[model samples]
Target chain A: MDDQDQQLVFINWLEDHSASVMKVARAYTLNSEDCQDLAQEILLQAWRSVPKFSGKSTAATWFYRVALNTAMNWKRKDKPRRESQQPLIDINVPEPHGPDSSERLLHQEMIENLYQAIHQLPKTDAALVLLYLDELSYQEMAEVLGVTENSIGVKLNRAKKKLATILNGGCDES
Target chain B: MNLDEYRQAWKEDEAQMNITFDSDLLSKEVLRSHQSFQSMIYWRDFREVGVSLVMIPLWLLLGSMMSLPWTWYLTIPALIWIAAFIFVDRSRHPQRPSHPGEPLLFYAKESLEQTEHQIWLLRNIFWWYLLPFCISIMAFFVNVAWNSSDGLLGFSLLSGIGAIFLYVIYSAVYRLNQTAVTEQLEPRRDDLQRLIDSLERETDDENAGDIMELVAAISESESGCGACSGWLNWAENWNRLVPSWQTATAIILPTLAGALCGWYSGTQLQIPEMGPTLFQVIVGAVIPFEIVFFSICWSSSKKQKKIQVARDEEAASKPEDRIKTTSSDNGIRLPKAPALVILVLVIFLGVMAFVAIGAFFLHMKEDLNAHNAQVIKRSFHCTNRV
Candidate 1:
């Protein structure tokens, strides 16, 4: 309604979803420096586009869409980044007992594997997995993608199978 | 170990992170963009808006003073003010110089390139082409009020011929001066072009799609795409005629017609019986026509010759250079001896008036109108020597 009120809401929304933005940037460029630049560019575009935003889709969904589109279409004029080769972080595996310390370290390792697995999925499918993992409703994900809610479920299922196959070292197909 | 656990961890990680944005550098660059765009949009055009504001009051004062029913002497201030404003405005707002650091040779080349469009706008309109024509019209009305017996015939002929003469001289002089200016302006035009190009390149990287689309649109209107060689040829020869005595003589035809009318009027006042003579009719109609004919003929001849020469030269030159440099920078060459032609024409007109008076005296004597002949002779004697 007012400038300050609008700005506060936008900053709160942007800060809450910055990890999603960083994940999209990481997909395009695994190198930390390049990832930071890509993230900054996405933020700049989002800031410039803020005045045009109308209250239809939730801010988080809109932010997710903008970040995803930037990463997918990001054609760097300089050298393109190489595909990331780092091992995937394993987020789902529970630790076999050691101490609470060992359990926390295992949990961190699992979260790191999950992020690496999301980065490895083909760019579009990786975005679907990230949003699906965040528990975005199929309708909200569809609104962000400008597609039907049914398509979102189909894409999310496909993305999950793809991620699962990447995480499992091809031991299991979907 | 479950999908729900992974989803919760991801949302928590996103919520905990911070992103910072700094746009100061970008804002500064956009501010410094193109100079021509800067000047045209913000500075030079801004002054034009100022000029328009100043002009409103100036014109209003001028209109009130000129239209006010004061004695003829009171209008002199308004006339002087208008004349002064014209001179000041011309000098103060001389055309902006071309880019800086461009060679003098290139300046001259660009001058010639821009001559036609510049001259056409300046000569035909900007430099007040209509002012003299409008003045001549006003003069016709004045002449009518002063002497109704001669009818509108003499005044119309005089003004018509005079207007054509002024048009030729104005056009010629403007073109000639244009040549000189182009020679002086080479460095500036080059600098301006370079600045524009650099700005374009900067914007190109930042806005690739928008810049590419704009450049494509501009390329469509480019001068290089057609065989405009002939037009340049015409411009060059028309330029040559500017300084010639022939142009000056042509421009003075109206004054000559006016002088002839004065002489006829002086003599007719003496010999009333010879007022409607056949020679007078021929002189009145044919002389004005001849004056207009000579001015048009001279202007055309020079234009055609220039075109022919330019065509040959342009055909030999590289197509790319011809496109970039043609028609934009030709400085108008000022004519030498402008005053001499004007002075000579004025004197010649005076002499023609005496000739008309003498003819009236002769007609009266030959027709055996002795009283009228003596009166015509006395009037001619009293008038200063032709």
Candidate 2:
């Protein structure tokens, strides 16, 4: 694709699918700054990858592939530095604004707990869980992860059980 | 809440998580990052190739300026070979394909392949990187030295020093690369392999039997069965007959002591006609010193065996008790006498052996010299009388 075409497609795709990018980045990083860093990296990689898009898979699937791969490799390189740095408080927690703000706050807390649990999973499992929480089908998850659909079922089942256990205050097996 | 509720909440929260980017700025930043990434890869390649590029011309310049022999030009081919070899090897194992859009397995496998190729390049650095340079450089030095005024002596001295210097440098380079492979690349490769393995592992019960068989095969190969196990056990028993430190000390300490003693005796205790040379005394002292050292080792080994047997019995009788006994529980034992006494005895024996051997050889030489003189005198006298 030409630069102009690539830019147009990328901006359009970002508009529609920026949620997946943010979710992936948040799942991979601890705090907002790192999440933002990872998100930007994922976007950059996605933009660079736009020229290679063959329309073989859906744009969401292709973008998830780029984002997750970028995040995985980034985490691998950043692990030492991340491990050394003290985790900053997450600043991206949503403020409850509606009249049923109490209920919304509870839901927000649950989501926070869920993200913490997801962080405790192995990188692949964490990616699988993110895709699952995003409501991707087993086929899409398999495509993103490069595993068979059956393997996805097995792994996702295992990851869900592990995530539930972590949520329930059980030890992480990661 | 159920997972469905959580999923709903998660999707609902995406609206609250706003990530706005200015498209123009984003494009610019990405373009810059892409350029930087491309340059980083190019920079790495340049770092590897730049050394040869600089060195080849520099060496040529040096050779011409120094008026080195025609053989010095041979280094050009050798240097080019090194550069070409690096370039070809690197191109053959180009950086992992940047297809981030591909599956995780593909990326991981590519990363692993790149790491393995790096390891291969480093592990065999001697063949491609060091040896050719070593040979070509040494050959040039030898040729220059040969054509010089002093000839063989000059050649020997210059080449000997050059060889030592080259060895130090090449070995250090070899070690650094090997260390990089071991400490960095190998671990990275293993991590990638593990990730790939986890992704590719089959969850089907049909493959369970194959995995079990593979595990069993590995275990059998490692532990061995029947006669092989017996021999391995026997070898293990003999291998630790004496503790490693004890064995090393027994060998190294005595040799050092014998050499020191021989050096002292050869230099200080010179008997004009009967004194041994340093080399001869060292040979003589080393023989006796080794014998005495081993005798001490044998005595210690016997004591250790007795202690081991007692410990074994104790362990067998109290299998339920987890705490184990160690031989060092008794005491730290050295050769029965004080160190001073042992040293004195060792020195005495070594010196006596050296003196005896030296006197015998010196006496035989003296006698042969006298007989030759006497024979010459008799022939002269007979000639005069005739």
Candidate 3:
């Protein structure tokens, strides 16, 4: 397809799935600025990769794989850049917001807490947790993660337990 | 919270996630990255071809200036070998369009074919490289030996053995590269393949296999099997005999080396001016044997692995026979070393040492007689002077 046509399709997909990139960036980076850079990279990659999309996988699966892969690579590349000047920024800690229903606010707190727990995970485990939180099926997660289904089952189980421990504040025990 | 509770929260948050980049900037970035990616691939291929083209002429010039009659002839065979190597390599994996950017199955297929080609080169590298290399070295040796009346026989013997050493190096390199492919690359390739295969299978496309088979057949027909077909068919038995060959070399070479060192020390034969010191000869004989023997043993360990894979495949294909075959033979085991073999080796070395020692004393006797005659002549001269 022509550039104009491709861009139109990409804009539509980006509008739908921009959150996946942002989420992956959050997990990968140490700050909002790095997250912005990573998400932009993911968007660019997705645009380049859209032509090769075989439609063998769901759009979400494709987006998650692209965003996660791009973010992971950006983190690896940007590490030295970060280490040279500033201290590491913790992106997983939620911004303090004001005014919402108590129930909605509680759920938001739980989600933020869950992301914090995931952020502290090993990179791959964090990815598994992200996919798990998205409620992707084992097969879809396997495709996105490039992990075997059987291995994913084991890793996902471990990741869930780890998340639970973190959420329970088990590590906080003296 | 559990994922079930987290799902509602994700839905709410996802709605608010913004597209941080404007379309104009995103489009510019996308176009630029794609352009750079294409250029990078082209540069890689260009650099490889450019270096190779330059080196070919340099090697030819160096060979010509080498101090032997056959050195100039080296270029012809060298040229032929390079042409054949490239031809056979290309034919073995008919040049496919590269897919650097694709992921999953496309990546898998590309990676698989590239590695398979590498493995093929590793397998048959002797024909492309070592054989010609041996021939060139043999030519140089023959030319030098022909000038020495008695050294010609020794030269022939050493050159023939040298070719075997070249073959050993070829096998060791091939098996090493093969092991890497088996251990590391194959699993990733298989995983990607499995994913692709599952997707295809889910579509209930029964004819997918036939279509893929047809494509494979066409590609394979255009490509030779990366071997000298005639030689391969003839030497298929060599694969089975490889263990015995290693055993023979381990026992024979060390004894031969010891005998040569002993004979040279006895002054039985004049060593060649270039690279024929007893130490060099012994090391040359012993080292290649050691290299060949060790690699053969290493490759043999891989046989048990292959057997496991085979057993699994067999079980999958025919489940009824699984119980019976559980205790079946793993791939051809290296035969146990019998007592008689060790005894025979000891006897051979003993006889070699005896010959070497006997020659040394016999030569010493001649020197002693010559010394006695000189002493007698000196005594006669003194008596005449008085």
Query: For each candidate, what's the DockQ?
Result: 0.04, 0.14, 0.07
Candidate 2 residue lDDT tens string, B91-112: 8866535567988777676667
In candidate 3 the C-alpha lDDT for residue B235 amounts to: 34
- RMSD each, Å: 23.0, 18.2, 18.6
Tens-digit per-residue lDDT, A30-103, candidate 3: 54445545555566677877777777888878887766555443422222222221211112323336665666
Specify the highest-lDDT model's number: 2
**How many residue pairs of model 3 clash at the backbone?**
0
| lDDT: worst 10-residue window of model 1 chain B | B211-220
Steric clash pairs (candidate 2):
none
- Model 1 agreement with the true structure over B1-386: per-residue lDDT tens digits: 45566666666555544444333432232222222133343433335445544544554454354332223223344444444554464455344333312222233334333433344444344234445434543454344333322446765665566567666866677666566446533333443344234222322231211111111111011111111222332343334444466766566566456446745754565445534343354356346645664666677778767976775465334222210111122233222474345545446544554455445434533544465577789989889575
lDDT of each: 0.47, 0.65, 0.53
> Model 3, B1-386: lDDT tens per residue?
35555656877677644444467766765555455445443444444344445556655554443322544356465655666566555556654433223333443355456645655665566677666766775675455444322365776775666566666876687677668667754554454355445323423332222111101211211111211222232233233334354556665666576556644653545543322243344444445545654565576658746965775465344422210101111132222343235345446544534343333333333454566788899999999999
Q: Give me candidate 3's interface root-mean-square deviation.
A: 20.8
Docking class of 1: incorrect
Backbone clashes, each candidate: 43, 0, 0
Task: Find the candidate with the highest TM-score and give its number.
Answer: 2
